[model samples]
Target chain A: MIDFERLRILTESAKYDVSCSSSGSSRRNTKRGLGNAEMGGICHSFTEDGRCISLLKILLTNKCSYDCQYCVNRRSNDVERAEATPEEICELVMSFYRRNMIEGLFLSSAVDQSPDATMEKLLDTVIRLRKLHRFNGYIHLKGIPSADKKLIMRAGEFVDRMSFNIELPSERSLKLLAPQKSKVGILSPMGYMATEKKQALSLKYNKFLPAGQTTQMIVGASPESDGQIIRLTQGLYKKFALKRVYFSSYVPTNEKNALLPTSPVGILREHRLYQVDWLLRFYGFKAEEILDENENLPEGYDPKCHWALKHPEFFPVEINTAPAEVLLRVPGIGFKGAYKIVNARRYGKLDFLDLAKMRIVLKRAINFITCNGKFFGTENQLAVKNTLLLTSTDSVILSQLSMFSNDEIRQSVLQGEI
Target chain B: MITFIFDGTKIGLFTCVFDAYYERRIPKTITDKQVQVGFYDNVYQIETDTQKAKRVSDCLKNCKTIGVLKDVSLALKSGRDDKFTVIFNYVKTVIDNKNLDVSKNFANESVLAFSDLIKQITYEVHRFKGFIRFEESVDGYYYAHFSPDNDITWLLMPHFASRFSNQAFIIHDVKRNVLGMYDGYNSAQVNAEDRQVTVYLSDDEINFKKLWQTYYKSVNIKERKNHRLMKNFLPVRYWEHLPEKQVEIASF
Candidate 1:
């Protein structure tokens, strides 16, 4: 039987790795299976830290050989250690699935003895879950750095998703902080998996990592600027076709180290990176246009609004005639809003009131759009900038002070109501 | 002013729409059976006929895509006072105009309101899927309880039935006095009129609940304590149903 003490030690040690999302895979229940993965993932609950709990994210063993400074499971730490057998993990997952407590399983592990041995044990649990237990729910396995390439390939066939964390931004930092891990040890498997996924698509081999791969980068752990981090993110998406790249704000776990900072990285920096990521993926903004190579994203305004303020020539696009791509670049217009405008304009000419009724964030969009030859925004650029600054500052302060109370403000933020 | 009243059912609402169309007069208001009648309005009580309801549904299916039928059905389940009127106006517009793409016709208030009402109900269904928590009972059956703002018990049945096909489970919406029971093979609905019912949880189940709460507390980083954001994702209204949100007692 798994005791609560062992559970506490294992889950606490695994908490620092934040990849809680369980989306991007769909599977039907078999004849006698217990669960099914919905097309859009289900978030079971949100913890006090405001992060999603979609999967039973836990480590197989909290015993490591290599010592990574930022990691909680490092060998140097004098924390309590624990390990559970494969049968114990299977039993825990089945019980949780039956209770509707979790949607799937996210199994990671420390390098217990060796990378190959760790990967073998992780593979055994998933293989048993699928074949022996007939568990058809989602499973996301974390690829161990420097693990055998053949083991990674075989494991990919059984699981829905896999991730190899590019922990630090640059190679120099990896050598300094995490001496045992190298850049080649991480990127080789990522490159192999990307190629295999592509070949699987062409050869009609379905169910080879159906949910795709995602990686995480520690934002403030290294000295790389936001510009450098975003450039790397672009390369990952462009080259590997990554489903997502998560940016975790560095929390001070080991403050006594000389290389690491004593203070925790603020959440606002992480929030800014997310906004810039949205601009890259959805808004069709290139990394160069967003920020310079040496400069970080501005803390004062959002990436889109910041881009708008820098280039005044792109403003005042006619709402009725601009294409969908142009509408997406507007400050307040989002993917949903842009599509709504494009579809509704086919029926009749749209104005500001109609836009409001359709859920457009008119406060921000008003300055950049002209509705049917009439402009409701300030003609002077300076006045527009000041107005935007005032409104944006109010929202930032309000969100920082107390969130979730005001429905209007939340809707405004959701609908790009900047 | 003419007020049309019908039984609180989807077929009854559709039948009321049929009556409004055949009579060639739009009622000032449409309400379900539970709603109180106005003091000075001319009230018309319409009995629900499946044939008439089928005829209205057939017309909707024949006129537009199946998506329109889904929206109308969801709108009827919203439990709104004048939802029938909103759907009636929307269906009439779709049937009257041949070239009108009702999906894009946000300019029409009835179509817009009908779609928005449907969106609200569907959104509630999606949210409850994630928010519902189940506990194992002494008899080895799993039970979950929730009180959603929208009447979405029926919509949630299919998802749980598919996911927990091997387990016997019951989802009880205490506020609506309705329960959806799934017993391994088939699922059924039970009317829970008493509202006060309890389940005896097993010893291991109680301990599992404590373990889950402990896991929640352990995973939380104190520096990122944003209760506001937490409330935004998991609202305060849902705190009662969550095991993590419950206050721990020293009895164990």
Candidate 2:
């Protein structure tokens, strides 16, 4: 068994990495292997911070060689260091997996000794877990940026997903905050993996990063607007075919660093960015359509509502006749709601009562939709804006007040408006 | 008005549907529990028959394009009192409008109610897949205990059976008194209304539990504590069985 203290140190070091999803890969268990990956991902537990603990996210070692100013495990820091062997990690994963304590392993490590050596250790651990241990569970490996491309690609064959963190968004921020890291060092590997993954897919190969790649950027660390970050995200998705782009709101771990902000960036900004990210991915929105190149996402409203309010000519879409994409743009109707409307309207015309029965949030959607040629919402745009703002903030206060209620009310409150 | 009582099994519920059609009398209420019958109300007891059940099941499967049978099965598994009436009314609608696509018509109250019930049951099944935690027993077998809102212990068998193909484990639903057991090669479910067994943990189980508890604590960023969101995902009912949520008392 791995020592308790070593596990704590390694886990604490890796906690700041925000990508914990085990989705998109559906690798099945081999003849005698232990586990398999589900396509929708399974979150085994949620921590006190409300983050999902899908995988046993831990580091092989916390010893570092880089001195990134925002990082707690920088080389200059005097934190206690520890390392674990490949065999020990394998044993720990197997035992925890058998007992259903975790879904799989998320193996990351600081640049211990050298980048090449650290990548070699990760590769060795995954290969042993696959070949010697016969474990077929999900494994998400962290890519060492400056390591050799060949070694990183070899490691990709054994894991489900991999990530390279672009901690600072801009090259200037990279130089100022993390002088040792470079934009080229991060983006080049992502480009190389994207090309390789495309080639593998063309040849009908399914072994190279079956879940594809993802990268994270610190939101409030350096000076980058939400619009700029989102455009960069769009480029990464279009260029590298990344599965996800995560944004971690910067939390101050080091004291009195002149380069980094002492006060932490609040999580509401992070939440707004995620809302905009969803719009870009699923809501048929372009980054430019959501916001300009420099303006941050508005704090008072969601991206979909923000876009809806700005284009007044698009208001009052016919609920019965609008296309699926138009319904998606309405303030309160989600993808599921739009689907239900499209299907249900095929049989008969949908009215406000039918919408309410379908659980569509009519409070916000009433302002944007006309049901059977009847409009119930206010015609004034300012009044509409105030109503939406009041309801949105009302939910926040309502959720807070109901925090001590019984389970059923709490569940509905958590489900939160359609 | 007439009341039809069943045996609370899938076949029993289907038999009620069979009798209702053949007798040509729509039941005011279909239930498995005993209810107070008024003087003007008619009461009927439903005896489960395989032939009648199969006939109704076959008609449902004939509309397999819409997966009516699947909806019926999942809806019946809910612990709700009105599940029988909800499914019966929806199945009647599908049969009444056999030529048209009635299942997609969410404007119909019966169809909407049935869809909502299925959604609830399916969401619970998905939640339990992650919420179920297993502990190693002394003999190297794994055991987990949970009390889900729906009778879904059996529904979880196929998922874990394929994932843990080489391991032996048992999942106990304390509320429903049912046990889903998988023994390396095959899986089965049994009733455990009066079953009792003492479980002794392996020597290393305590050590691993402590390690997991410690890891759970360390991974949380204190700067981003959001208990509302935590309770939203994890919920208070599930915290009872989770080892990480249990406060450890120091033992001498």
Candidate 3:
């Protein structure tokens, strides 16, 4: 049996990896394996940044070969190190799972020995878990970049998810900061995995790398703007049909890494990226519409609010009259609310008071809407801008205050209550 | 003054909306009776027309996506009494206008307001999915009771049936007094009054619950004790319905 000490260390070490969503996988139980990846509610415990850690999110070993500056397990950092045998890990996971301590396993590792050897150990652990121990619970294994493609492909068939971290957005900064990790090492595996998963899904085989592939890019680690990060996000989603691209706000874990940002990334920029990500997933707003590759998203307001301020004539839309699509564009009237209006408005005329009853943030929406042909907000562009700025400040204050509320802090973290 | 009192839910809301928008009927009852005074209170005795009700349902069903159906259900479950009817009626008018105008201009203030209510309702549905906890009864039936912020018991029915089909279950909406029951084969509705809250358990059922309770205890990371986080997402009130409460109590 793997000692509990090694298990905790390995799992906690892997917690920083964010790609843990279980939706895309369709693997089921076979006579040989003991578990399955059902699509229902076998969810990974995702954090505020949307990194999934619910599974036994851990690494086989924390010892590293490469000196990636942003990594906590970087070569020069001299942190305590531990490694587990494949048999021990398999035994640990099976025991935890039998007790229902975990729904699945999220196994990742640092570049120990060599990338090839690290990849082999990861594969060995999963193979032991599945073939030897009959431990089939959802397994998300990380691919060690620069590891051989044959090993990567063989590993993909056994595990549900495989991610190769882009780590930074641009190739130039990637070379500068993470010289040991190459762009090709990350992108090629992702591209190949995407194509293979598609082909597997089409052929109705348990999709090879069932949840497909996801990559994480550390924001503010390099000087890449939000626009560049988002462009990469959009391109990945469009080209790879990637399930999600998570943003980790760069917090310099290593003090010696001069290439890294000294202070933690402003949470608001992270918040903006999430809101922009929401636009990409639900609302039809493209990355190009929200920000440019050279420019960062506005820190003052959400992307929707910033976009609305840019276009003035669209305002004072009649609340009862606005189409669901237009209602979604209004900063406060979310996509869900827009659809509600489409359904409920069929019965009668709506007013501002009714909007309040629906729990919409009327303070933001009121400026842009008219209730029963009555306009209540400033039409003057300057006045609207000034009022919006004041409201934005208040919103920040509200945002901070709101986080501590029993409802906000708890439910938000558990359900990712955004 | 139309003294047309329909069911005290979204259907009631829709009925009031139909009378006012199409039949020019006035509301005799409201959450605030003062609003119905003078001009708002003037009564036109509602001539009950099933035709109008059918017409309203047809029009709503015609324009209905999965979203609007939820709004109607939410307003029903909201139990807000008369104003819910007011919101429902306003929403109907917006849908009709969509057929005519198909643009933002046609929806007006009331339509948008109705839409916004649907948005909050959807959030409630999403919250319900996470908050819901099933406890096995003595009769071997799994039961979950919730007083959601919005009326969405019916909306939550399909999710439970798909996720836990083999188990016999009851999802009760305490506020609306409605329950969605599934015997696995046929998932159907039952009134809350008919539900008997039983605690009797056979040996096998007790054994299963014990095993389930046993499994629930082992998974948590004891060191990362975020009790504040736990209590916040799941308020203390919900513990009464969960089978694993004693373990949580012991841990604390």
- Ordered from best to worst DockQ, the candidate numbers read 2, 1, 3
Over A135-247, each residue of candidate 1 has an lDDT whose tens digit, in order, gives 98889999999999999999999898999999998999889888999899899999999999999989988689988999998989889999888999999999998999989
Best prediction by TM-score: 2
Q: Between candidates 2 and 3, which one is better according to TM-score?
A: 2
Tens-digit per-residue lDDT, B1-252, candidate 3: 434544454444555666767655545453322234355445433434566766666676666333455446555545344555446555555575545433232235554555556656776675565456555566777676767666577788775565444557788777566788888657888775756544453444444345334433333433334566666555566555454565566678
Tens digits of per-residue lDDT, candidate 1, B41-157, equal 778889999999899888877774346777776777775666777877777778776456667667567767877888888888988888888898899988999888777888999
Regions more than 4 Å wrong, model 1: A390-418, B22-24, B33-55, B79-82, B96-98, B194-198, B248-252
Local accuracy of candidate 2 as per-residue lDDT tens digits, B31-127: 8889999999999999999899999888876663378877777787898998899998988888777777787788889988888889889998998
Candidate 1 reaches a DockQ of 0.61
lDDT tens readout by residue for model 3, A1-418: 5544555556556655655555565566555444555564343222222222346667889888888888778888877788988877786566445323345777789898888998988898888887887765678788899999999999998888788888888999999988899999998988888888888878988757767777788787788888888888999899887777888777667465567778777656766898888889888888878874438887766788888887777787887777777788887889657865666576578776666766677777778888889988765544454445535336433243254565534554465433
True contacts kept of 1: 0.65
- Model 2 lDDT tens row, A1-418: 6898898899999999999999989999999888999999999889989999989898999999899998989888778788889899999999888878788899999998788999999999999999998998899999988889999989889999999998877889989888888888898999899899999999999888999999999999898888789889888889999999999999988667887788999888999888888887898898999995448887777878888888879989999999999999999999999989999998889999999999899988999999989999876665566556635338533234344765635554466521
Q: Looking at model 1, give its docking quality level.
A: medium
The C-alpha stretches of model 3 lying farther than 4 A from their native spots are A26-53, A95-101, A128-137, A201-206, A292-294, A316-323, A370-374, A390-418, B1-252
Q: What is the lDDT, from 0 to 100, of the residue A323 in candidate 2?
A: 97
Choose 1 or 2, whichever is better by lDDT.
2
